[model samples]
Target: MTAQHAAAGQLQLNYWAEARLQRWGHIAVPLSSTRVAIHGGYGRDGKKLRRLDDVVIVSSDGTVAPTVSSTPRPKARERHGAAAVEGGFVIHGGRAGGAFGDAWRWHDDVWRELRCEGSPPAPRWSHAFVALPGDACLVCGGRGDAGDLDDDAYVLDPATQTWSRVAAPAFPVAFACSTSDGQTIAFGGGRAARFADAAWSELALDDATAAASRRLAACVCATARPGELVVAGGVPADEGEVGGVAVLRIGEDVKCVAEAPLDVMRAYPVHAAAAFSGDGVVVFGGGVPCLSFAPVFGDSVRVVMT
Candidate 1:
């Protein structure tokens, strides 16, 4: 475990006591400017594998603790999409017993299942979701229940409490990382039909960038600045298992710069990343070394200082 401080070019990583069980496919949504709420994941309690329904609150002030929500909790799920909405956080489709189409809203320290209007997307897992402007959220490609990959997209409006399908992506991928800068949303590498591929896709635009060629699957992405994004911790296409981090600068020409390796080899560490106030990104729990069937778990919290 290392403390928080700046290195010459390397990002600073601070390790703390494990707040919750080491798990993957969990969602972390920012509750406040300095605090984030972490939701469900697949993990083992002792010897049995279980889908967790735990909620842990992580604060930038170095406080990590669990929150006890009111009764009538949502079903334990993993690979779900969570986005901060008007008054609270909205959690959408994920795999519980199977792929789930239900959506839940968390507000005032309580969870309420939402009955939305319009046709919702099919049940899926490991999809990419980004909070859009005007209290809306966009959900993209993932793997369906029948083991088929999805190319469809959907939008959820909080104001109207409705859902609507949107334009599909050229390449349908799952476990990809995505980040939005209000104008455009960029996604990186993910599994297509069989093997993982090096590909990049964008929403609302067709302009491809040079940084799009790097293959990164199951990684976490966050906006480091207004026009720049930081992608960290995932398995690369060429690499056997482990992966590193990179900074994507978006402008007239998008390029990845200031690449660095993480302290430990990790893939699919955090389902969603929380941005630091200054210049860093926080990575929560994820699988380490490799994504094997009986995977080894990682419990440390990593921060990439840009």
Candidate 2:
């Protein structure tokens, strides 16, 4: 891992952590106090796995520590999808040896089970989900059994403990980076079908009603911001990753404004995570070459848009 300073007086970019198998699966989350939280398993010497049950907190003022502990951790299960919401973070829909469709929330120093009814999403892994500004969450397609892709779309209302079916414009794709800009939900590149094709989709919410209009083609990653959905680095095929950052803004049609204009091209399986910080955006750890089952990059890069 290495450290480099970016731009003027922005945050110091630290990329000093080596990649391990268990560490690669961790996800980066930004805290309310301008710090970052990383949760996962880390490999110490390729021989032992360090459980990342604790949330690592890093601040710009040069403070770092673990906020929570895994000693008395929640139920042991692989986390595939996560989103930071009103109270805390909600983890959903991961697979172990079999598919998992359960939802758990991490808030107030404890993990609580969240139940819903009315046709829940099928047990799936690598499915994409995002919490909207309101009490709504949208989950999309992912890989199912026998290497088949799922095309189901479900909306969970935490306030009502109910689930409802939503229209799926993009079908048969897993590992897509699905996120929202408060109003519209966008999904971008992943293993589309069995052949490893690349594509994108989106759902726009009306100003008055919170109903999603339809799915559109404006792929983005977890690193996207509100109103601005950007695809930093993703795989064009199953073989390798691309360095180009495909960018799109939410408007009348949700069109692509730029492509690969950034300084870096992301590697494959780059499960990038980001959050809004202050006036700009804060992007956390991501993987390379392919979707890493463990955490790879351990840097906190702060992005301030012009």
For TM-score, the strongest prediction is: 1
Tell me the whole-model lDDT of each prediction, alpha carbons only: 0.62, 0.48
Residue pairs with backbone overlap in model 1: 269-286
- Clashes (N, CA, C under 3 Å) per candidate: 1, 16
Model 1, 99-214: lDDT tens digits are 98778888767988888999788877777666776768777777678875556777888778899877665665533333455434445442121111222344322222223333
What TM-score would each prediction reach against the true structure? 0.80, 0.67
**Model 2 CA deviation exceeding 4 Å by range:** 1-22, 30-33, 41-47, 50-52, 60-62, 69-79, 172-181, 188-226, 256-269, 288-300
CA shift of 101, model 1, Å: 1.1
Q: Residue by residue across 207-250, what tens digits does model 2's lDDT show?
A: 21111111221123333355554444333443343333444455
Off by over 4 Å in 1: 1-10, 44-49, 173-181, 188-217, 265-279, 288-295, 304-306
Could you tell me the TM-score of candidate 2? 0.67
* Index of the highest-lDDT prediction: 1
All candidates: CA RMSD in angstroms?
5.5, 7.9
